[model samples]
Structures are given as structure tokens and as C-alpha cells.
Target: MPPKRAFDAELQALEALRQATPEEALPHLTKTLTHRNNFLVSKAATLAQHHNLTALAPNLAEAFPRFLADAPKSDPQCWAKNAIAKALAHFEYQDPDLYLIGMRHLQPEPVWGGNEDTAGPLRSTCALALVQCRTINSHKLLLHLIPLLADKELNVRVNAARAIEQTGTDSSALLLRLRAELASDSPELLGACYAGVLSLEGPSAIPWAARFLPPEDDAAAEAAMAIAQTHTPEAVDILKSTHKRARDPWFRKATLSALALTRQQSATDYLLHLIEQDTQTADAREALMLSAPSPETLSRLQQLAPNPNN
Candidate 1:
């Protein structure tokens, strides 16, 4: 577990941010980022946003003579960069201002993302900051980050895919390439790709994602249920077929319930059977019956298969 001091310090910093002006927060922000201790490193970026210093993105991008004057004073490059990214997000797309000042250093690299060793938090922080800015600079970020889809670390790839999804580019080629790059052999990678494509949604799901999901995998079942929730007539048919083909009965039932929605005939018997199952998943079974229930549907429940538990 992380130490309690970490949480307390972060809360205190956020509270101070709420109370102070950007200039006032500047000293504290710098102190946090530049601190020799690693404890404050994670929060530096978040602190920058709280002060609304993001409007200064232009100056920070170009000279940030202030931030640069201090960048060297700060020990970690990651900490400094993250803080700037947070500030840019606090403002929205104007990150070029900050990126401009740090050109020499940033030019060679462009943008940053998670790699094998990184925890998901920082990369996600950067991606969301970029997306909220909604600038073209971030749209171009895909080129820099696309490679990380195959990152050795699972969480890194997860965050990378999430970032791409946030950018909301339906780079069919990119998504397909990532899908092809992952083998059916590696279920984890398949799971990640499934998540990645599901995030993309739309008709893109049909030909592209159909192959990745097979009947009965818990993850695939979940995806089927999710697709059913879209309520597109075609999506509904596909989900129904997907569920029928699915070898996992319980998950298949869940998929049917979601697809059925107000269409009671579709799930009526299956849900009633599940509710009367007298099993460990009884809670889930009961919840499904309760959600999206119809009185016409309830009439069938009275005739449900007898269960000792019921």
C-alpha cells in the first residue's frame, strides 16, 4: 500500500491550490516538482493544473525561462514534463505554448507515453490532458504513441490504447494492425485489443472485431453484452447470434438480457430459468430480472421452474 503521508500531502496540496493564486501556487508547485523526494513527484503535474497556469502555456512552451530556470533544479525530467502537461490540460489545447519553449528537448522526442516500466497513471494523465485540449498537436500524437501498442508492459499498452481511443481517431489501419499484431495465442493481448476496438465502437466493430471474440470467453461474453447495449437493430441481431453461439451459458444469459431490453420475448425464459437456478450467481440473476423488467414478463416469473431458494 502507498503510505498515508502521500494521500494527506496530495489533499493538502490540492486544498492549497484551491486557496492560492497561480503565482502563489507557482512557488509551491515548483517546490513539489523539484523536491528531491520522490513522494511529491507524482503530484507536481496535477498541482500545475489547479492554479490555472495553463494559459501561460505559450510562454512555458517557448522559454519557460521560469520553468526551465527551474527544470534543471528539479531532479526528474518525468516530473517536470508531467507538471507541464497537466498545466496544458488545465487550459485545454494550448500545450504548444509550453511545448514550444521546451522545443530543443521536446523536439527530439515530441510527446511522451508509458513504456514497460511505467505505471498507467502518468501516461493516462498525459493522454487525457492532450484530448481535453482537443488540439491538432494531440491528433498527431498517435504517430508518436502508436508504437507503444506493442509495449512489453501490459499496463503501458492498455494506457496507450486508451489514449488513442480518447483521441477518437478511427485509424482503422492502426486498430487492425494492433489487432493483427496480437495473436489469438495470447489471451491477455486479445483481451487488450478487444478493449481497444470496443472503445472504437460503431460499425467498425463488425468485420474488425468479430474474429477476436469467440464464444464463452468471459471477456468476450462481456464484450457481447456491451455491444448488445448499443441498441442498434443490427447490433442486437449480432449480439443475439453471438450469445447463441457462445458456449458460456451464464454470460450468454447476461448478453441476452441486455439485448432483450424492452424486447421481453428474447430473454423471458432464459432469465426466468436463471432467477430460479438456486446458485451462487443468484444475486446477478435476481438483479437482471429486476432491471428492465416488464409486468408481462413478470407473469412468466410466477410459472418459473420451482427452486428451493425461491
Candidate 2:
């Protein structure tokens, strides 16, 4: 009956359920979903999701609000709520209200000096899930999601951008562009926005992203990386031009790294040229290796700059 022993027994029981037939596991999983322990409830919800137990979604739903009622104590880290929401999302639960509730929920538990909101992950998960809800049109969803782009949590903002990207609307692309322009700090967030715009608008948007390549800030690096992800000849050209124009060594290195990520033959050839010409040789070599270049490229690199150790 001790807490630790009870926890161990519960874990063993959950593990055992993994081996049972779906029918046999259902009742046990259902019962465990109601357990007071947040950890156990989280594990049970994960099992439910893993096994594709759509049948227990209602139970998972019930447990979600129960934990939310006294979130700080009942779900210190929003563990139970997070798991349940993820499971529900996996099931493609169509109800927008539940996701809406979770997207707005904020549970700030006590930290060392003050209270830190533990519900950011929960909000992020719900935001992503909300995108899949067919009932809510893109406009309404964006209305709800737009505010989260400025969320206090960096991860939440990043995921919020991703969720908007999932909307795949022209409006969504514009929203990302606006965010990318307005966000002065948080390169990661800018990266997400850049990626979203690239994804939504395709190759034509490369120029728009390239504009950010100036100023040689972290935002520029993010823009370079995002453009490189396109893996198009245009991307290679854009990166190459940017690399040539960059006076900042850091920006040049970052552009080379992005060029390597493109995996295009032209990008590879350009990097090899840099190494052979002894222009940013170390960085070019590092970029080539990091890109996992083709065997021919690798052989050429070795020839151009033979390894002393090899």
C-alpha cells in the first residue's frame, strides 16, 4: 500500500496489459485511466494510443478534465492531460471544443523563484490537433491559432506556426510572412515561419525568404536553412549568391552549411570548389561531410584536400 510499491505494481500491471488481447486489455486500461496517479494515467493513455484503442477515447476525455480541475496537484506537469490529448488527437477525435479548451488552458505551477506555466506543451499539442478538426474552418482555426504565435513559450510559438502551416491556406502563408517580418528575436520561431511560408507558397516564395538573408543575423541563418530545405536548383542558386555577397564570416559559414543541406549537385560542386580553392576550406569541408555527399563527391573531396591521417 506504500506509494512507491503501489507505483511499481501499477507499472507492472500496465506492462502486462501490453501483452494481452485488445478485448482483455480494454477493461484494465479503462480502469487504469481512472487511476488517481497522473503517471499511471499517462502511461495508460499512451497504451491506448499505441494499441489504437479508439474505444477508450471517451474515458480518456473524461480523465482530461478531471486532471485539469486541479491541474497543479492532479497533473503537476500536465502529464495526464497531455497524454490524453495526444491519444485523442491520434484517434482523430473530431470534437473541436476539447481541443479549444486545452489550447487555452494555462496551468502555472510553482518553480524555484516563481510559477512557470507547465501547460505550454499541452497547448501546443492541442493546437496541432485542432488543425485536424474538420468542423472548424481554416478562418476560425487561424483566429484561434494566431495569438499563440506570440505565446510566452518558444516551443509553443514554434508549434503554433507549424499548426498554422498545416492549415495550408494562402492566408496562413501570409500570417507566417507577417510573423517572420515582425519577430525580431527567436531565430527558431523565424525558422518555423520561414519554413511554413516556403511550404505553403512553394518555390516562388524563395525570394521572399531570401530577403531575410541580409543583415547577417540569426534570422538570416534561419532563412538560409529554411530555403535550403526546398532542395531545388533555385535554392542552390540563392544560397550560392548569398554566400558570395556575405561579408560576415559567420553568415558565409552558415550559408555554406545551408548549401550543403540542399544535396543538389550544384551545391555539392560549389562546396567542393570552395574547398579546392582554399576559400573557407574548413567550413566547406565540414559542410560537405555533414551533408553526407555522394561517393563521387567524397572521392573528389579527398583528392582536392587529401587527409593527412588517411
Candidate 3:
């Protein structure tokens, strides 16, 4: 086993390499790829990817077989596989075999304890990586990924949903399946399904999604946020209606929070107005923070705060 000091040094070196430009650090990074330590190899892959080292494609391609062959028997190796997939997804290189490997990893395996909840991190990472595959055969890969929408693992389902959404293909059946899954009650699942639906059906999804809003015996904050994210005239109207009708303070706050997601000036004006109201100032402030308010919104928030100097 490597000594603590040696391991620490290796970590430091990888961090330094990550900060270095590809041009200045490619030589050292290429060497690190061959390191016996899985961590070092993973780090090298990540840094190469972050730098968009297209020049390193051949090296990454060479590393793919080793990463897949090793098969991650333990947690650390599993993490290494995840890192490798994460990096490869960012590579400009496109290979059908590599994409297939990613797809294979997305399938629930005995390694994942027969449940997606227990699936190794690599499964989720691999699912996401497959989405980045841009070959002519990529759409075929996506068609196979549709089954993963109902994956027991939230991570798998969410990533798969995002991948399908990115294709800009209609996924109404996929959305219906996701909504039927018992785990769809999860806020994360709802958010992913909504994202896919919005991409597939646009404003048409608003009314469909609003049925889950106002938290009727379920936490629908994410669903409401999804509606707000659409930023359509219809969506804004729904948010306003939901907020007006919300009887529970928490649900009201969630509705108000979702409104912050809209780019519409009306939404911002409402939030600003809430910030001045005694009953809503606290929730409004929190909602604005969550929304990542724009510069103009920031100035307005500062002006509205009782003590802007603070």
C-alpha cells in the first residue's frame, strides 16, 4: 500500500495538474494515466477531460478497455470506473464500442445489489456518459435507454431522463411511465420527469404537471419548480393561481419559490413585492437566493432589505 505521505503528494500533484492548462500539463497528465493507483488514473482522466484535451483522445481510448476490464470489484475501483466514464463523456472522441460499454454499465447489475438504490456510482455516471455519445448510432443507444426511466435507482432514472430530454425527441410514453413508477413520488423523480416532459411537449406539459402541485399529501416543490422553469405565459399563470390558493405556509413558500424560477418580469416583480411584505419577506428572501437572482434583481433586493448596509 502507498504511504499516507505518498498518497497525499499524489493527490496534491493531481490537483495542481487539474489547475494547469492542457498545453502545459499534458505530458505529466499522460504519464499519470498509467499510474498503478486507481485514484491517480481517475484524476488524470478528469483533468484531461476538464481541459478538453482532444489530443488525449487516443490515450483515453487506450485506457477505456483497462477501465472496463478491471470491472471495479470494490468501492474504490467502482469510483475509478465512475471517474473514467465521467471523463470519457467529455472527450471529443466518439466510439460505438465505448458508448456500448456505457450502456452496459447502466443496466442494473448484481454488483448493484439487485436494486438501483444500491447500484454503484458508476451506473449513474455511465448512464450520463452514454448521453454524451454523439455517433450516428447514438439515437439507437437512446431508444434502449428508455427503459431506465423507471429504474429503481433515482440517480439512474434522473440521468436517463436528462439524456432523453437532450435528444429533443418526444418522450410522452416515457413521461407516462415515469409518472406511474411508485418512486415518482420522490421530488427528484418528479423534477426529472418534468424536465423531460417540458422538453418533449413544451407548454402542453404545464397542465399535466400542475395536477401534482400544491403538495396534496406529497412534496411537490420540485414539480412546481419544473412548471416555473418553463417560463411560458401559461406556466406563470399557473404559478400565480397556485400561490393564491395555497393554504399551507410551507406549500405557499414552495409556490413562491417556484415563481422565482421564471424569467418573466412579472415573476420578479411579485418576488420584489413579497420582500417588502412583513408576512412574506423571509420566504421571499430564501426563494430569491434559491433562484440565483440576476444583477438587477440583486440591486432591487438590496434596496428592499431593511438594512442594505449590512
lDDT of 1: 0.52
**C-alpha lDDT score of every prediction, in listed order:** 0.52, 0.93, 0.69
- Report the Cα lDDT for candidate 3: 0.69
Alpha carbon lDDT of residue 141, candidate 3?
59
Candidate 1's displacement at residue 9, Å, is 10
lDDT of 1 by residue, 17-53 (tens): 7577777777666555544443354455555665666
**Comparing candidate 1 with candidate 3, which one achieves the higher lDDT?**
3
Candidate 2, 15-131: lDDT as tens digits = 998888888889989999989999999999999998899999899988888997878998999999999999999999988989999999999999999999999999999999999
List TM-scores for all candidates, in order.
0.58, 0.95, 0.78
Best by TM-score: 2
Q: Pick the candidate with the highest lDDT.
A: 2
Task: Candidate 1: give the clashing pairs.
Answer: 45-83, 57-97, 57-98, 58-97, 61-97, 61-98, 61-100, 61-101, 62-101, 93-133
Error of 2 at 191 (Å): 1.0
Q: What is the clash count for each candidate, in the order shown?
A: 10, 0, 0
